[model samples]
Target chain A: MDDGISHNNNNNQILCPIKPIRCIVKLGGAAITCKNEIEKMNEESLEKVSSQLRQAMISGLSSVKICGMDWSKRPGNSEASPTVDDFSDQSLLDSDRFIVVHGAGSFGHFQASKSGVHKGGLNQPLVKAGFVATRISVTTLNLEIVRALAREGIPSIGMSPFSCGWLTCERNVASADVSMVAKAIDSGFVPVLHGDAVLDEAQDCTILSGDVIIRHLAAQLKPEYVVFLITVAAHDTTGGMVTKIWEAAMIAKLGIDVYIVKAATDDSLRALRGELKGNNVPEEWLGTVIRLLR
Target chain B: MDDGISHNNNNNQILCPIKPIRCIVKLGGAAITCKNEIEKMNEESLEKVSSQLRQAMISGLSSVKICGMDWSKRPGNSEASPTVDDFSDQSLLDSDRFIVVHGAGSFGHFQASKSGVHKGGLNQPLVKAGFVATRISVTTLNLEIVRALAREGIPSIGMSPFSCGWLTCERNVASADVSMVAKAIDSGFVPVLHGDAVLDEAQDCTILSGDVIIRHLAAQLKPEYVVFLITVAAHDTTGGMVTKIWEAAMIAKLGIDVYIVKAATDDSLRALRGELKGNNVPEEWLGTVIRLLR
Candidate 1:
């Protein structure tokens, strides 16, 4: 009669809670790749973003260490950057606990679309070939991004969905086990995930979009903020900016703020640093934000 | 005071049990790569092994589907292959439910040894660089193996220990959460794991050897048997054949038989097909088996 749902809830209640996740960052595939060129990475942009991430983590999380704050709950939007007084009081609640999810722009989209892999039919050899090709491409990028982050002293690990039982039903996410991601974060490592080709219940196999992954993580992890570092290209694959914005809006309904900023820009760093507001962006910062209205 | 160990036991009990694992196969790094050369894979050997795996699965496990056997426990060493009458009785207790774990071989040894990454000191930037280089080399090879297996219609998923919660303390495995591996197996995927560099509590980090991993998995999963597809070379940075045999001997103490066979050989295929025996090697069979002397 329980159907195991209540059993899982009972399981969760008894376990020690993980570090409160502060942000879920989405890196658009177009932002880090030469979209028109097949399998070409935008190295300069990637390096810039990595450096910014390092800076953001140091500035944001250092305060928590200095203050030795008990981060049980996420801070409200009203909270400002920590000051010396805040550190002394030890009430300042902020930490750079975030997960990075990236897209598979030029890395995988070509093979996926060409083979019609998104539709899924594993019996067909072409579809299977496409799945392998797509995974190789996307996982290559995931490892590259993880290596770049590691160079910046970030303990980043690549977690591929297909390798971790992430499944979809007719292009919709049917089941995604985020327990490993949660454990990775709890053990003091940044988890880097990517869009991947996964098995489907109905179609046999299909593409599991990174946008869908972000939304699912937001719902499950309840991060305080979600950041989208994207660059829209004229010719794009995998639904481009429209799908990202739509996903962002859906996540906003959960009362978490969402920032859409161009990658490698100061605006991206600003969003990461918790500076840019939903409706009050200055001319200098080029970005948009989504927030739920009370 | 409870250390939450009992709580995890309670959590596991409610979850659905996975299929009984018939085997845990180890593809030695030396067997799959040109150990003398840095970062080179032996493509021919890899292809042969992959094809053999496909054959073994089809031949050994196909009867289970036809007989519709309920596999609650692994078959004992005395049981032979299923027969026609066995199928009619619907009491065949054999299935090809197995997991693959490979080694780094020529892939990661050079970088890992060059930087002395086996002894960890994370503060040293050089150590971090070595970790990155080592991961790139090994993960590159892991992807190649996964792709090879995929080509053979084996649903292989590469699960890196570092990406999950596998940790070591002073080079001994302190904690390894095989929950993801179990989930992958339950969901009908052959989880492909590899020797990896992991975080160490005593040392800043250390290499978690494939030999150690095999022992841990055998102790935890209690598979019916284990097969080591290995090649003993003149030099091995990670203890070579001696360590493998010691690990196999240790596993044998748990009532699980282990076979040490030459990679890509007919004996290797026979070992996988459950044909080889301990201390009774035929002239054609080029392998050694370690079995507890009950």
Candidate 2:
């Protein structure tokens, strides 16, 4: 699989550098939830996505090693090089691993919009109500997704940001302790996260979109690829496809390959395997690839 | 409720201090789990505890304000004092709030003990398996507790430390980001945490008992009171009543009051109310009171 390392600057000195992440899959809320209905989950779509994920894990897609990493060969950087001992192979045990971040389609948007939760005013009663309602809604969806994955024999743990100090200040991510995510990945558990109502330094509270979460995780984990499972159509209170595309571009800027693929299709699997690598649009590939223009 | 404030040295400059935490309730594993059987929940006991918690919340047990604060009058501190603006009333809204930490009795002890997970050797497949198994077992129980709380109309969210960077080095808590717990309390949601496996720097992994979690939180949150819900008898892999009492004494040394009350009794409600204060053991109190010597 070409060592599964992208041609980008991986110069960030991450704490305790582990193996580069293999892939990050985003299950769009529309693909997994009945957006028109209140808090309704499209169980069929969720089941299909879970099954595909199970197949991908069992195929050993995440245990690949990124070789040929030179401390002094990276582009546009001048730093003291480490000794040869630092470059020793730290191979991980054979454990299926990946991360899943889902969105709040119908589950949380209703309560969030009604309470104006994204605006953040703790002094207001409605905002507090909205925040609680939105959390319950999104966390419930996260639980269902974990259950679906568990039914397929996947060890998935729900890791919501709201209660884990993934806070935003002035609507931008101020601080997020990804060490837990790193440890979970290192321990071979599929940590499932989602869009959640988080504490904001400027605004009292705000809805942290799943797209932002994906960008943050990619930057931190430096995954080789990110796959977005797109649904046909749906109502969304956060944003539309344009926002997703913009988020994807931002992630691509970090040198991670981003694929926006149709959900419940063979291309999803192809994207997971890093098999859709072509500059030209191929008829067989059912997704658009976003990457740095090399 | 004596404004629900303790005599503890509140000199620690917490990041953006909100109102003080009212109380921290420890729901013993034996009280809510069938210790003799694997993965069995004592639904009847859970329902009773949940009902009592609901009663406490609806009675406005968490909203008492700690008045009469003069930063200049505090003892044993020679730090610079902040202006009056720093001590401005940051009173939280009248949303019932407290933190709940539960133990893993039969649910997780089997998996953890069988795998010798506390010893921490990530290279060994058994330790890794034990990590995943223990996490799954405890998290499943946390979900049940949240469900029980929700059924009784409590806005409870499961916040497990294993998936949130709550790490221990050499069996002592190295770091715990309590900002999320603070934010949840400020926003009026009851945060439910549990004992589980966490990453260790010295050891590869180890069990983080609920008692240690209580002490860590007590130091950070500085709640007015702490209540330990005790069961008559049970098997515990983490530690038994002795460890719990030791943990309670440790909390008491911090100048905050601690109570060890029998579960399924009205004394639990009394502990939550901070109404059971006496040096002499009252026969009607039905619990042991641990406190610092004046």
Candidate 3:
């Protein structure tokens, strides 16, 4: 409700369409929740981060926010072999231009690791259960994040990756049918996506990371900025923590600036809001930058 | 999301259930959006409704809330005629027990009326398109309602009725397979359902209402009270405006006390949370109480 919260860094010559700044914000589970707890959400952190995004949106910037579910699931919450995208498409139809995707975190990790679904190339019962559990875990978090955004007055819709995601035989995201996502953004609704259990042509079903989703979207949408928010601080290792980091690098070569907020804070948000000195701010210059190797 | 916001209304003699007090809060389209406009959401009204529900939840009550989208859609939002409920199950895995179902207000009305899908007698091309369009409209508002609840930190998962619903030849809800809803509620998650274009054995497709969803859930779950929040405030036909009345009479036969909040106000929400004295309270006793004629 602040009267003066419009775009502040748009004039930096970041190249793209003539409309609002089409950006993507990624949230890591660690940043938004207590990683050790089951379905635990950090309201203060989430509110601060959401308020920052809200500020950006109000300021004339258009972006999609994705959350990483590194550790947000509780066990015994899944049932049978279930696909993840059953409820995704319709959500895309009416979301604010902000697209979101989150990681499976605790929800799928045990099952995925137990079933060896993450590594792909398996059809064991445990792995099958892992796929089901993974979908449940990620989706559970997706609802949580969606509800959080709803409270924030941001019309952010939840899209299960399996609903629009497809993977290669090698366990990488092959397709995410993001046309609805594109349309949603164009129409001004935030489409929320998350790292989820996706059906892989080769591996049966595999993990699709929020990072991978961002890269694919950057390539497809060709947005001005692909921003990543790692709520949980990693051990100085990027790319490896999330899926398809190398692919994101390839996207950066496509002339898109990939910015990462390793730790989402008021200061970093302010910095992001502050215009870049030029179109090409060095990758290191940006906080938690995820550089696709040139 | 908010650590302290669990259902506080259950401790009182909220009636029936040995578990949490299961209730349904129905939001008429008029209560949350401008019935006249296309895809426009009344944030103020929605906020009021959401806050009240949040209050009830915080007060120790377990319930499923449904939003009515009987008139919440415009045009040009459909793509390639997609089926709703693409991601339905995954969401239910980790949702709060508060179940939600909204009317297909604006989104489905036109196509539904044009194709006569509501009548559910035949299958024609327009009816098919109407099915798609209607699904999109209802889904659109489903996302809106989900977003609203998300903002409130209530992990309300959206469910497409068609995903788990079926209609009989009479065009009424034959089955809604709300097992997932029951599970979510048992697990303390809110399952958000909405009126949608569900498949019919005879009519091909039919319009499902949030009211019907409540009635259906009442039978299977046997919640202590079937509470309906008529946000539209349709005339002064009953308790003030939208709380209790006729539709509830249809549900009272189940031996459940029916409470209606004609409008989303503090008093009504308080009243809904208040204990119902006997098996029957006078109509004027509460905002609007419906007693089935013996």
Candidate 4:
């Protein structure tokens, strides 16, 4: 069951079978964690999102999930840096019924890139150390993320992808036993997960990306609304503040809509309204996503 | 696999096979979080524990594992209380090679007590609702625990025992696939787990105690050292503070020694030294635990 490479596995008995008008709000690491720097977080931005979630639950969109990652645009740091150890460990985002998945930024990329872990199938001693390093780094950040959410009164728990999900031979998520996450949501508790180094059936271990997790979760959880909040000035999308994803094929396939937004609170809240009451959201609340994956 | 329990089933290949020196640090809910209040955490106490771990790693014991649960005590609160929703999810504890399992305090006990989940084999619809409530309550506390540990620089991740470990018809931990936790420890990241409401093999869903989890982990992981950090005042051991546990029969059977401590940080650090480098710790740093189950 822990084998890593069997992508697109499904079980109707599990994976959010209820289809409750749930929403997944993704806060980009760059947006909240200051993409350019190492070991930094945007408290103000995170606080805003946190408050929005508190208010939204009151507004009736109680079944919601939030996702984010420790995404970064690093200029490279010397291992000698005093704070280098701190960069690898971070925490996650918040919301009611939050199911968070974060990317490994400064924490994971360095060791993974060094050991060439991204190339797949590591069998060497030192390379295995790299896998270990990557887990330490990303999970370190996961701790911080969970802590930040806790301070804001959002009781969030961290679940390592390697512990809960397996990667495929192609270095993609084959199967993630995310029923725990779903169960957490059903009980109204937030489940904070992050993209980390995972055990691969074919590759031994590999990186699982946050975007990939988001898509996979979107399909399985069947959240009626999805919002990707890219929280950095650097990741300004072409379609502007709100990019409505036009992945007709995906929407038709999964029966869910996605958006890349500069502002997730308003968009997700509106999307939730559109989902719960079937109300027509104002046009201004639309199109904040990068559009379809294709 | 997601079922609550299968019972005392052991698989050495997947479980802890080697007799590495590991420690189980149990942080009582009252120690770190104000058990009487809703959603309040003790930062100073948690910070002290975090630093002790950092120093412990610096002193040579690197293969350390930490386990704590969201244990709490609460006066009766009506469902009508707005804050009842906030206590379910909590945070975690500290350390590098950490595995945390917390008990449900005010968050879980209320619902589980009402649901009779502990009696095992729940079949009624209302009982099912009780299971759901327990999960929400406990997992909520898990979030806070993870967050607190993260704040203190522990790269902690959450795992729901309900999903990972199963209970027997008798409600004991049947089996828990904790390989991910071992892998996390191997990688130097702490795996934060909590007492969760789970679907059982015999019972539909039931509450799994942190103590049961600790015992199973000790047996499977085969840690040379184990400590039960009971932070609540309710559990005053007859032996007084710094009680050296002489569960000779169980120790002989399991080949592992455990201590029930009141002061987790110093006592655990001393215990780590005693296990790692064969240092004689002072006798005063013992006892700190309440009564243990015979």
Best by TM-score: 2
lDDT of 2 by residue, B200-250 (tens): 889878999999999999987888889888787744555677888899999
Could you tell me which 10 consecutive residues in candidate 2 chain B have the lowest summed lDDT? B66-75
lDDT of 1: 0.71
TM-score per candidate: 0.74, 0.78, 0.45, 0.55
Best by lDDT: 2
Cα lDDT of model 4 by residue, A34-75, tens digit? 545444556676666665654554343334332221111112
> Candidate 4 regions off by >4 Å?
A1-5, A8-21, A60-98, A104-157, A165-168, A232-252, A264-268, A275-294, B1-175, B182-210, B219-294
Q: For residues B150-240, what per-residue lDDT tens digits would candidate 3 score against the true structure? A: 5454545565555332344466665444433443354344667777665565655567667777777776566667666665444421123
Candidate 2 regions exceeding 4 Å error are: A1-16, A36-44, A57-97, A150-155, A234-237, A278-282, B1-16, B57-97, B150-155, B234-237, B278-283
- DockQ head-to-head 1 vs 4, winner: 1
Give residue B226's lDDT in candidate 4 (0 to 100): 58
lDDT score of residue A274 within candidate 1: 73
Name the candidate, 1 or 2, with the larger TM-score value.
2
Per-model tally of clashing residue pairs = 0, 0, 96, 78
- lDDT: worst 10-residue window of model 4 chain A: A66-75
TM-score of chain B of 4: 0.68
Worst 10 residues of 4 chain B by lDDT: B66-75
Off by over 4 Å in 3: A1-294, B1-21, B60-97, B121-123, B231-246, B277-286, B292-294
